[model samples]
Target: MRIELEYNARSIPPADVARSFVPPTPHFGRLLSRNHTLLLGPRGSGKTTLLKMLTARALNSWTHPEAAALTPQVTFNAAFVAADIAWGKQIEAVGSFDFNASRKDAAFVLHTLRAIVHAMREATELAREGRLTPHAKHLAIEITESQEEKLVALVAPNLSVRPALPSLLGLELALEARLDTINSGEDVAPFTVESFPSKISLLISAFNGVTGDSDRRWALLFDELEIAPTRVKTFLLSGIRSFDERIIVKLALAPYMDDAGFERNPISPHPLHDYHTIQLSYPNKDDARNFGEELFARTFERIGVDAPSLDLLFQPPEGGSQLGRRGNQKRQGVPEEFVSLAQKDTSFAQYVTERNLLSPDYRFNENNIAQDIRKVLPIVVARNYYLRRFDGTHAVANRSRKSHGLYAGYPSIVEITEGNPRAILTCVGPMAQDYRQDIERADGFVQVSRSIQTKAIRRVELLLTSLLQVVPLDLGGFDAGKGLLGFVDTIGRAFEDRLLSRPFTTDYVSTFLIDENVSDAVVKAVGMALNAGAIIHVPYPDGGPDTLLRGLRGQRFRLSYALAARYRLLLTLGDRISLSTLLLVMRGVDVGDDQRALF
Candidate 1:
């Protein structure tokens, strides 16, 4: 048997999305409320999936346990208007024909209105066919022919192009025809157009008139608003502050709003006041593991049988011989090399002695080591694996080496995926196939080996690095030879260098804070990196205010653990440093084409 999960929500049909939906904590319930929202996340952070699942079609199709009681709470009729690449192109092209800024904004709003009408039409058809859930059926608009004509007459009068008839299709056709004229770049005269708020109010009134649910609200779910025109984005931002009472505006955009009128900062809409902002960026360590484990278990549950616990499937690599080859010798609990390091390196020996794992004789009792080092076992394994002989001494460490069972197991996989659903699916999909094949050959569940897990993680790293390399970044004036990839690699290798440095100290530099006096081009690169998920913003861990980046200065960011394998860095946050120091080192080295993306 084989199980497959869709990585991209846009490609999934509306019904399928509801069927496979896993409600992201806090965001889903908050989104279901009547408050206006700005859902900010990077690409593939389940933004599209969440927005689409709010529609009537998906709500009716939902069979999840919470659907029974929760679906009815979605009182507003939702319209999923996708401001995707095609819509962006059409809206921007209107300006190519010398359309005024207001005209471009009007066109964007018109298209948005058309999409709402389309959603209503689809819901009405579903209700008429008896395919909608009871709550959704009541939410559907049942417009009579007379009411449709009245709607067109009231709404289409402000349009430069009027509808041929008084029906829904006619209104849509009129909008389409007008869009086509704009797209053609043909000469035309200036004409009257309705304001965005006015048009939206008219539609809501028309919807209420038909549905006979005057008290019910309407949600305009706009996906990918970052791709919309600048004027339109500004208009929408204003709408977030003040909009129609019956209209709920939910805008989806990237975390970095460099293009959305905040050239020096990310989009920072005041949370809880202007609009409720739901961040779907990389979660913290504990949250990531819990959510990722849900996805992991759900993947196995698709096989139609009781699944083993996640730990049973991808067991953590044990220390010593379990992690690496030890010839044909009897397996000891701890590595002999670790014992040797304690004998040779006084610092390492003293560090162990402090923990009581080492005796006064500078020898480790294998039995006592296991019981004593249980808490710091991972650190022990990492230090042993990465520590190397330099200048006839083991004081200084080597640059990271091949995996002695690093970046494996469930916890590591969760960290690598960084709470992104698309990333989780991409990493687990191949392993699930392997699990299926393994079960068919054997009777019981087979543990996915560390090599397999490492391979999956490495594949994701390559794909991400390759994407950053190909996508052009507007560095403005800063020339770093290799564009975004070079910027990311320079930081990544620097972190790796820190991880492997010193007298075996655990407190190494991993995260970085952007210096206040850096060039604008560097700040732009950081913004682009945040937008692309190459680096993630690290909020203060002590429940401080979740503020957006006004500028990169003093803001802390860590490279995505998705690139951790490529640099052999740990799957944890460490001490921070100024980014300027790292850039200074990069500037000192003559980085050329050969030095691009060291992975």
Candidate 2:
């Protein structure tokens, strides 16, 4: 049966995205917790969808079994407040809202308070509609009325013209109009900074009053903080520190906001300390696999496909081949496969063995030869040839001539997907579409060809590359964009030199260590790449036991199979690269527009 997939979530409205959302495994529990939280992840990692789900759950409309199960764990009456900061238009419209050197903070805080009040009003309306419990309905109304009364009292005495109603919305409109009049040189008292703290205190008190007890809580969910004006975001974050325990603030932030552009100051509250962080992206391989499976299953079900197993969908096409038994033996340290493959070319095995004898570090002992065999055998068996020299050129390497079946199996598809949701969506949609088109053209049931898989994978690579390009990589002092390009180039060269091995049946390209002293910008950029499914981070084997004890850590960044294939950086199995070489290359290489462009 033919199936269609929908992969791009950004084009969908928030409500629709929430309706089809699947909670990522790692952070579902924390997302339901009452503690203040920062949901950090790259675009398309489902941060906005999660926020919408939370908003739906708060209103009791999200009836999915998973969301229902988590409802009992929540301790708060929650409301979602979107920070739609239209800085340019707002600055032009609000004449009296001066962002002067001395009064910027006041303007920011005022704008933020307006958004919160608006959200509180929305929550009150929800309660009136019976979405909330009877007790909550009464409390919401009471708080809304009281907060409106206090706000009116604060702004009424200074107004040249009185508002018709003592409501918060009326006061805001009147204040804007009054500010405009004052900016035209009319003699009226301006909204002062000293009065903002008191007004904000009253609003907070109203929010706290809704709970009526310290044990009860109210959550203010803030979304799109990454898009908020700098002054506005600074004010909001600083104000969060003073919130009482009864009020929880859950913020949705873009990945590496601080590293990308937000300035970090010692005086501001640290995200790690002030709030719990729920990462939306997969942290490891297992998580990626599980998430990928869940997403694949969901998509299949939506398209009326009975995909009971991800393995079935990803199964290799008939006639596709894997490494031979001898290659498997080489993986386990037996050099028979390597010797046999090389022997096909008249004593090449003996020639290499004899050549190794001349070098002090290249002994021809069984252990050393077996290691070499492990590294070289897969390349030979896959390409069906042996390289005579370690030349740094992919053009000369014995790569597969049959491009169609190279990426033809379910296991191989999973490797290409790298457990990334967007990658899965972008890939599966086109593959399914192609499969359907093929069936229609043949006028009967038809199998998806290897060419289709290759095309879909290429499309995913281009999509990822495009996504990565938009992630701002300049972190003030560190040139992360350049560093990342250099790093990828270094891996490409390593693959050409036979220093890193490529996986035939999996998505991992090769792993190389990152130095401890790598700048945080580069580290975060790597993380962004991982979130984009451009790469994956593999911790050192044995968890680098001593690094854990010593509190020293290093990351092994593995190129995503799709990206490696796109760049022609895929290597043979068992090849390896050193950290020193990578660092040297990264420092020396220059990134040009040609290198950055996906096309």
Candidate 3:
């Protein structure tokens, strides 16, 4: 029962990953549409995997029954010329081409054209190799030949030696040779930027010919465009706008790329008017949970686990007796078993009483008692919850309090990972391995041990810490400075104070209410933090007004649980904090100070 799963999608080939891929429904629907799309998400949010899934190779390799069933309905019915390019690397490759610094913009356009041609060529090869359906193969050949003819006609005037039409190989060779000649300090006819749009139009026309007039059903799946040179990005965006109806240009971009100054490029058009955007990551609680369930189920099945559901893996032991009756109905309180277990330890008993676990009026008992226990026990038992143990004693503190320890459950783990496929796999893979080991060493339905919970929490904390560390570096371009980190810390402290004080807060906080009078600079910093996944935005109900706080009435923001746990803001998911109080705590603060304390 020792199961091993690949947590890193990059480590596996696209075909292989596609074999086990679980399609994210809404996101997948958007991806399959024939509209120009800009997919925005943080790193590890399955952008690469989604790109792979859209390719001809992945579609052809669909052996899984469920995924295969959907192929004919979407992927099989289309003439998709998918190209998985690491645009960052493409930018680097441009340096090798002979182009003056002043002509960088023109050079970028040429390089992009070359890339599009390369993608078409690669697609044709896949068809030639019989990876695509017979009809798709026929279309691929026609598309390839037509593209070569158009390309040669467009650039033939500048070429030292004109290549024949219908020979893509000759065109590629000639193009490369000419570039090499230019790189070696030889003079060549410069390509004009004015002709760029015409060349792109021809390429789009070739794609259109292959797909036919069937509702303009052709797609170019472009992955990792976030790292492309700014000029290259602008050129691509312009192409997208021009070919809006004829082709679907699907691009996977980092969140910050949206604000990467598209306006600065003369060729770029307004994104709001041109592209349909789909966020690859989950934006709310329900979406996260649904995704997590499917992901966990698939991974478990792959690893040979026979569990019915993900809940089984995290369920508490089952011997808790029902408490007294209330009005002929059960007066829900802590399970008698849990009460008995707590009684064995004086500090735990006090902790239970302080949290009102024995009271019928307690909210925890009204819900699933076992689930409530599972959530609270880990936080209470965390090593940091007590005073420092100089003598290495196991004694617990009399009162329940906030701890400088990472404590979380499966839900929080999913949230912290931010629906990143690799992060989720890696985070849960070890836990599954450990669980299998424990089962082998025990009897039927073994209880998840305290040590396992502790280890899992620590692992999640480490993962989140690694993710958070990248935010500042990534957002450095925004010049938000240390205030960005302070903003994050402010949210974390809010969670922490809630955990320590009475009457816990549960729902998301309003951004406007957090600090109504805060400067626009701080608000922008907060937005950067959101883009970085340091904070999450939970939109106001009905996309309408949020009237919770008086000063700021219609804005929304939610502290990310993963970040809160990483910073020891709160130990468990059940606790809530007051946003108004948190606002006061963060107000008038000089976040730029090097010595600014988080608490």
Ranked by TM-score, the better of candidates 1 and 2 is 1
Clashes of each: 0, 8, 2
**Top candidate when judged by TM-score against the true structure:** 1
For model 2 the TM-score comes to 0.66
lDDT of each: 0.68, 0.52, 0.51
Q: How would you encode candidate 3's per-residue C-alpha lDDT over 556-579 as one tens digit per residue?
A: 566554455444443223322334
Give the poorly placed runs of model 2, Cα more than 4 Å off.
Answer: 1-14, 57-59, 79-111, 130-201, 207-216, 222-242, 254-274, 315-397, 400-405, 438-448, 468-556, 560-562, 568-580, 583-599
TM-score for model 3?
A: 0.67
- Candidate 3, superposed: residue stretches over 4 Å from native: 1-13, 73-111, 131-166, 169-195, 206-217, 229-240, 257-274, 304-307, 315-416, 439-450, 470-487, 501-528, 541-555, 567-599
Instruction: Give me the overall lDDT of model 2.
Output: 0.52
Give the per-residue lDDT of model 2 (tens digit) for 1-599: 54545565534544466555776776767787877777766555666566655543332544345754564666555555555433322454566554442244333344545555555555556655665643223234334576567656654554333666777567656645553443344542233443544554555564455434335465666676766555555555566666766677787765434422323566655555665666554434455666677777776556654456655455354433333324434233334434543444333345455546334566555666554554455454443332323223222344342343445555566556655667778877767666656656886444556778778778767776666666566544334565444445445555533322221221223566555545655555565565555654444555421121122126555676666455444322232344444444444543321232110
Candidate 1 vs candidate 3: the lDDT winner is 1
